[model samples]
Target chain A: MSLISLALYIFEALAGAAALGILLVRNVFHAALLLIVCLISLAGVFVIYNAEFIAVTQILVYAGGVLVLIVFGIMLSSRIAGKPLVVTNQYVLPASLAGILSAGILIKLFSEQPFAQQPGALPGNPMNQTGIALMRDYVLPFEIAGILLLIALIGAAVTASSFYSKKQ
Target chain B: MEHTLILSSILFAAGLMTVIVKRNAIMVLIGIELMLNAANLNLVFFNRNNPALSGHFFALFVIVVAVCEAAVGLAIVLRVYKYYQTSIPDQLTELKD
Candidate 1:
């Protein structure tokens, strides 16, 4: 295969492995670390696909922000560290069966979908145009996302601080 | 080509299973994050071939939303832990039978 395809394969394998590791690992901190690895590898896949903007954002938002927050949350919420979180036996078998069936269906669909070959070197310089569109055509959704973010921040602060309230 | 999509789907399925089967709140959050990443992977793959940058933009927005969701969800989980002394979903079933 071509060099680009080879690189893509390697990155995809790494990403998939990391994601699976996150699922299997019981330690919450280690799981979060595996998730960071998965996210970074996925960002690499984005770069291979010429989605540089998304690649950077994946690293910035996921690896840098969300994963850190998750790790902190695990630390703050759990009294025990490096231990397996409590697991329930109620739905494990059914959930596994359903997961396998859905995965099979998705794999079938993916195989059937006719994906065109990368046609004539995809436009490598769309970042500027994409930015313009975000600010112009998609201004409303963009602003709405900002407002949502603000509300989330306020909500988190309020919820967290409420824990420290003195009882009257 | 097709393999990438298959892998993404597997990731999504595994994440869904984690969310459904795992009792820990943090594990559930991790599963949700994994599912979101799977969707982002699909968006990036489509953006590779499509001329329009819509998929890429949507992926960007998804990333932002995922971050906000994680922050807020974790904050709630922390509050729950403080009040209930546990983050296990089955144990926090005050509303269930």
Candidate 2:
């Protein structure tokens, strides 16, 4: 096998293992940390696929932004409860069966399909191309995403704030 | 190509299991994030050869949506925790009390 393929394999294995660890870990904090490992390894996988921009965004948005939000959620809720958040599993047999069955079906379908694997390389820097595409062809959607983000920010703030709490 | 697909499917399955099994609402949100990441991985991998960079742009938009989802979801979870004094979904059943 080529070096790139070898690296891909290693990253894939790490990501899969970390994802499994997230599933098996009982502590919410530890699970979030394991999810960081899984996400970073997947970012490496994105790099192997020549999606450097997505890899960086994966690290920035996912590992940096979303994870911090999740950790904050954990801490806030736990403080209210006056205890560490301990995740519990329910319907283990059914959930595992569902997971394995879905995985098997998807793998079988993907393996059966014939994909023309083109090792086509982008001409310019991917980030540059992405910027141009966003500006030119995808400006509408980009603006919509901006609006959506604004609404979400306001909504989160309003929802989380103690504006209408009952007198306790 | 196929390897990436399989990996994404596995990730999706794991996320599904997590959503089903975990009692904590935040953990369920984490699982949803995993599933979204799996979809993003598939998008980037499939469109790697395309010149239009559609998948990359789509993944960017997906990340935006994910951020929004995480923020709003966490806020709702916190609100629920504050009012109910519990974050477990099963423990909260009344729509309005």
Per-residue lDDT of model 2, residues A12-37, tens digit only: 88888888888899999998998999
Per-residue CA lDDT of model 2 for B13-81, tens digit only, reads: 999999999999988998998899889988988887887888888888999999999999999999999
Give the DockQ (C-alpha) for candidate 2.
Answer: 0.80
Tens digits of lDDT, candidate 1, A1-168: 998889888988988888777666767778788888888988888988878888998888888888888888877776544454545434878888887898898888888878967623465567777788889988998999999999998898887876456552
DockQ, all candidates in order? 0.67, 0.80
Q: Total backbone clashes of model 1?
A: 0
Model 2 regions lying over 4 Å from their true place: A116-120, A166-168
Residue B65 lDDT (model 1): 93
Kindly state the fnat score of candidate 1. 0.75
Candidate 2 residue B43 Cα shift, in angstroms, is 0.5
lDDT of each: 0.82, 0.89
Model 2 lDDT vs. the true structure? 0.89
- Where is model 1 chain B poorest over a 10-residue stretch in terms of lDDT? B88-97
The number of the candidate with the highest lDDT is: 2
